[model samples]
Target: MLLVLSEQEKTSFTFLTSLPEQVYPDLVKTALSQLLSTKQITKVVNSAAAKLKVEVASLTNSSLYVLSQCLLNSAKRNLTPEDLTSSLKACGVEVTIVTPLVISYTENRDILIDIITRSTVQAPEYRSMEWRLECQVGSRSLHNTVIPNVLTKWKISDPRFNNLKTKETYLNCDVNTLQHITESLRAAQLELDTLHARKMCRNLARIG
Candidate 1:
């Protein structure tokens, strides 16, 4: 996923590029070596910052971006902000704003809610309780069903979904839509449970 960097963050990128070409590779190597030895992102980052003669907090955004790229390269794939943060925590870094760098996948979650509520998912004949979502991303559109099992679906999408990297499409929009539908269904199920519990209580009262 691409980072939609803030204006300040964009300006901060110059700090990274200003370093000598050789220094960049050496810095990456040092960070990786430190990570392997100490298994702590903080130490790896601290060591790199010391080499650059900069405080860790002063170059937080630039340093974390480099570290994030390292993690992604090692993993050989893309990671969500949550996954990236978890990986960093496992290595002992505590950078908080890394998540805000990437735009939220759930930003348009309500639009999907609006679409579903306007559809026939809740109609009398549609007993499946699932809605098929036809989403358009640029010239390419995909058809996916909103189901309760999103974790499984996301697993499937992990390897197959390339639209995320494309400038013309929003892959997370479809994913978020499915996740929201799952949540709404769960809420509806809980309400049904409560009503059933009340009905059972009324039946027992009449028997007594």
Candidate 2:
């Protein structure tokens, strides 16, 4: 008989199939829960590390595993993952995660430490600073910014402002909600990247 699996079921089965089964249900459940959390940490670490623009492929898995534990610890301490340099030191990752070549690529632990520092997004200081948005249509330009705790009707400097449009920028959302919005943006970017890759593959096949 053939087995049918949904995408989620396939993913779960692939992960679990490699592990040894235990007789105790509670132990299995706890292990699976930790595994899921670790997976999430790996995802966050990898995305954050990409901001460093380094060839980190060699230490990718090891670095993610070590960094994920620090991330979890940061949550317990109510600290930002942006405290990455200290967290890496606390985790003793500097000694284990890097080789001579990895060190040379990053030029030292200070640069490697930047992987987390650059990746983690801190709460926006909208009160002290506003984010700018600029647009141009046929040489007509428009510019505006979102200010914190301000609900004033902001007008663009250029006449083209009326023609240009943008999705609702969640200026009113709390910092936590803003972080969720960033995560959603990352997911959307990944989806677009996958779509573009598939389109390129199809075009290449046609050209061949």
Candidate 3:
């Protein structure tokens, strides 16, 4: 796929090509490492500029950020080196600059992919549900009344936390409300099974 670039990104990337050719490998390596790191992009760009004895603006922190994102996405999607080269060329990056970047990516693709897979955060998922029915025969204010209600507890697990935390939610509703909730949930399940909804989910997964 051809990688589309924003106007600002296109302008910023031009600054990348102007850097010394000898620095390409180190630059690409630094950019890739920074992508999987918590460090700020400015520090990386500024540090590179200092080492190269060039102005910080000349290094273009925005370009480095975009480069890192491109590398990360490409790795996540398992794009081939040839595919990455073409995509970068389509975006107007010089062959010289693309060469080292693509080389570094190819050499480290498996490692990057492993890191990404390990770092991925899964959305919370339903683990289990418990429900109970209760009948209230009478209360102090209403001596001769009956009320039926449902008490539900839902457990959800999130993989993002180190502990693999599970959250519990309690819900109380009358019979009528419980029926409505059941019907709504059934409708949602049917919607998810539809072709259109499935396709939309696939697209969202690819984007993510």
Instruction: Give the top-scoring candidate (TM-score).
Output: 3
lDDT for residue 166 in candidate 1, whole number 0-100:
17
Candidate 3 per-residue C-alpha lDDT over 1-208 given as tens digits, one digit per residue, 9 for 90 to 100? 5445567767767877677888888878777877666776777777888988788765656656667777778887788998898888898888888898898888888988888887877778888999998999999999889899989899988566733899889999998988898899999999999999999998777565
| Local lDDT at 51 for model 3 | 86
Give the residue spans of candidate 1 off by over 4 A: 1-4, 29-38, 66-127, 130-208
Cα-based RMSD of the predictions, in order?
Answer: 21.8, 20.6, 6.1
- Candidate 2 structure quality by residue, lDDT tens digits, 1-208: 1112234433433333232333122222222234343343444334434544433452243333323333333333344323434443343333332122122323333433454445555432222224443323233353463333322223333222332432223244444565687899999778767978789877664322
Using TM-score as the measure, name the better of candidate 1 and candidate 3: 3
Instruction: Tell me how far the alpha carbon of residue 187 in candidate 3 is from the true structure, in angstroms, after superposition.
Output: 17
Q: What TM-score would every model get versus the actual structure? A: 0.29, 0.18, 0.58
Judged by lDDT relative to the true structure, which candidate is superior, 1 or 3? 3
Q: Give the Cα error of residue 62 in candidate 3, in Å.
A: 3.9
In candidate 1, what are the lDDT values of residues 1-208, reduced to their tens digit?
A: 3223334444444465555445554444443344334365676667767877788875455645554344433233334546544544454332332233222212323432343344423311211222245544333353463333222212122212332321221233357676687899999778767978789877664322
Name every residue pair that clashes in candidate 2.
none
Q: Which portions of model 3 miss their true places by more than 4 Å? A: 1-3, 33-53, 76-83, 117-123, 127-133, 139-141, 153-208
How well does candidate 3 match the true structure in TM-score terms?
0.58
